[model samples]
Target: MGVVDEAARLERAGYPVIHLEKGEPGLDTPAPVKQAAIEALLANKTRYSHSSGLPELRQAVCDYYASQYGVRIDPRRVVVNAGSSACLVEIFLALLSPGDEVVLPDPGYPAYPRFITAARGVPVQAGSAVTGYQHTAELVREHLTPRTKAILINFPNNPTGAVADAAQLAAFAELGPIVVSDEVYHGLEADGCHSRSILEFTDNAVVVGSFSKAYAMTGWRLGYLIVPEHMVTAVTRMHEDLFVGTNTFIQWAAITALGDAATIQRQVREELNTRRDCLLAELPRLGLQLAHQPRGAFYVLVRQWANTGTSAQLAADLLKHAHVAITPGSVFGPSGEGNIRFSLSAPADQIVVAMRRVEKFLVEHPALAPR
Candidate 1:
């Protein structure tokens, strides 16, 4: 957030900052989704719906899983929220007692720990760097304790774009703790390979999904949680007490988003793939190392050369000197200290331009360049 603010300040001063920092898609919300919201508003469908979400929207979520993953979900178990972040907060609150532990991936999303801590749960780090940033049940088991209530996993993960397979998901399911799978980036795979949902392996899991990344609906604030039947009541109670309900018209729009999800997600995936390829080809030429090839999602975590200083320092220097904004991986976790994350949220041409600037920046600061 500090980097974002600093980038914004530079933009205000007339600097043409190339934004590789934003996690959102560069695309606008699909026309059909926008039109659906407009239609709902015109029809005066502004009244509050169920706190669990509009019945149709929840049904759409169920249908989505059925169609995409061939998994049957009971609509009664879905809870819509303002965003997936809200779902995370509700899940932690419902599942955690004070000091109960939740195992999270180191080098994972920065907000995961904060959400857990906010619910008075301890966030235990399971080192994923050793597994090339892929969180495996084997690594996570080493961190588990009697106090561990859940294992939080994000595939097509943030910062590091590693995707887990079915065997890994099955292993996580058998780990004797609830698996909270963040599948917000499920459909955004850079390769044409679709990601497997944890539900395919076990019903004893919570899925945090959003239309933000795949549908370009970040500003719409629409997301949903799919909980196990046993957890629905407890999670819904927390949602009802805190959020009451999500926006009525927006939920109506989400039904449309899911209805046309195939077409919409394909478009998003293609664009991200183009951007990803550009980075994969160019970043190495710029003397940066990709610790892991991003298979899903829109980020590439690049390792800085030896003696380039902390990831935070490198990120700040790039923003201040190159006018190219990116996230320092350190903010994600301690395991991310020597890396910086590049978000493929800009156009291919813009990304190319950003790389050129980075190349020049490295040349000016020779110590930052790889030997």
Candidate 2:
């Protein structure tokens, strides 16, 4: 966010900056989705609905999973909200007690720990460094302590796009702690890896999803959560107390947005894969090693930098000099210190140009070269 803010300051000062730090899909919301919202607005659907979500939209989400992945989820288990971040907070508040521990990936979404801490829970780090930057059952078991309350996992993960299959899901299910699965990037696979919901392996898992990435609806602020049958009411109550409800028309629009864009989604994913290919191929030539082949999401967390400077310093210098905004991986966690995350959400042409500028910048400042 600091990098984005700094870039914004430069942009406001008339400097042209290419942003590769944003988490969204960076595509315009689909035409049908926009039309749905407009229809809702014209129909005067602005009044607040249930704090959980519109019943139809919740049902649509269930139907989507059933058809897409054969993950048969009860509609009642789905709790719609403002976004996944909001759902994570509510889940944390409802499930965590002071001193309760949540085991999550180090170099994971930085927000996971913050959410746990917000609920007065202890955020325990399970380093993913040796597990190829993914939270395997081995890593989870290694970090398991008596205080463990939940295990948070994000596949097609941020920064590192590594994903786990059903085997990992089953492994997580066997653990006594509740599994918190962030599936926000569920449909954004750059590779052909099929992502299954934790619900497929464990009923005890809390599955989170969002329209922000798959449907290119970030501005819509629509997200949902699927909890075990018994936890729905508590999750709903906490969300109700905190947010009352989310956008009304947006909820109506999301019903249309869900499963409505197979072609658009495929095209977008293909484009992102192309971008990923470009970066993975070219970045290594620049002396940065990709932590792993990014199979999902639109980020490449480049480590083994040419420069001796810290990731934060590299990020800042690039923003200040090249007007290219990338994320310093240190902000993700201690394990992320030696790396920086580059987002591929920009236009293909712009990404090409930004890479060129980055190459030029590094050529002149040879000291920053990766060894």
Candidate 3:
């Protein structure tokens, strides 16, 4: 957050900054979703609502799962919050205690460790990178300590864009730590790629999702969590304390958004696929190797195969001179130090221009470019 804040400040100061830093969606909120929110407000549905969110929205969420994934979900297991980021913090607070160690994938989401540390727990970095930026149950097992209380899993991951497979997810679930699965980017998968929910493997798992990416509702501040019946009450209390309740009208609107699955799914699938291809094709020419073709999400982790400077320096150089912004992998964790991440969340035309700028910048700055 601090790094991004600083970058944003510099950008506003007349610098020609092209920020590809955050994993934000480049698309606008679908018309149907925006319409629902407007209608809600016009109808005087602005009062404070239940802390756990509207019952109808919760049921709509359940119906969404059954229709989309063929998985049956009970409304009692769902808890809605202001955003998935908030829900993640609530889950960590409820499930962790002082001296407890939580296993998180190195080079994973930048916020996972921040939340874990806020809960007074230690974040144990498991071997996600040793296996190509992906985590397996065996990796979790190797890092397991008597005090290990929970495991954090994000897929299609943030910086690496690594998606988990069924066998790997199931195996991780069997390891006995409460799994906090972040599925915020589930719908943005690439060609021939599909995302699996951790719920399919175990009820012990907690699933966190958002309308921010798939629906292009960044300002709506809407996200939800799915947990077993036993954990719902505790999570609800944690949510209540943190955020008395979320935006009432937005909650009602999200129900409509969830019900109209076909429209939203089709749009996100098309746009993200196009952007992914644009980035994948152009990145190599900028002197970075793909390392892995991003099968899901809008990010790709690349570094100078010829070994230039650290990723942090590369990212700074790109933003300052090239007028393009990307996240340095070191911010994610130690394992990501050599890599930099680009978000395909930008428009295809903008991405093309950004790529051109990066290529030209690298060619000019031979000291920074790989030999």
For candidate 2, write residues 55-97 as lDDT tens digits: 8988998898888778888888889887898889888898998
Candidate 2's C-alpha runs over 4 A off are 304-307
Best by TM-score: 1
Which residue window of length 10 is worst by lDDT in model 3? 303-312
lDDT at position 244, candidate 3: 82
TM-score of each: 0.98, 0.96, 0.95
Compare the candidates by lDDT and give the number of the best one: 1
Candidate 3 residues 158-219, lDDT tens each? 87788888888888899998898999988878877788888888888898989888888888
Q: After superposing candidate 1, which stretches have Cα over 4 Å from the reference?
A: none
Q: What's the true lDDT of residue 72 in model 2?
A: 85
Q: How many angstroms is residue 236 displaced in model 2 relative to the true structure, after the best TM-score fit?
A: 2.1
On a 0 to 100 scale, what is the lDDT of residue 232 in model 3? 79
Please list all clashing residue pairs in model 2, or write none if there are none.
305-370, 306-368, 306-369, 306-370, 307-368, 307-369
Q: Go through the candidates in order and give each one's C-alpha lDDT.
A: 0.91, 0.85, 0.82
What is the C-alpha lDDT profile of model 1 across 1-371, one tens digit per residue?
98899999999999999999998978989999999999999999999899899999999999999999999999999999988989899899899999999999989999999999999999998877788877889999999999999999999889898888888889999998999999999999976677999999998899999989999999999888999999877888878888999999999999999999999999999999999999898976887789787899999998877887888888899999999999998998988888899999999999999999998888898866656
TM-score of 3: 0.95
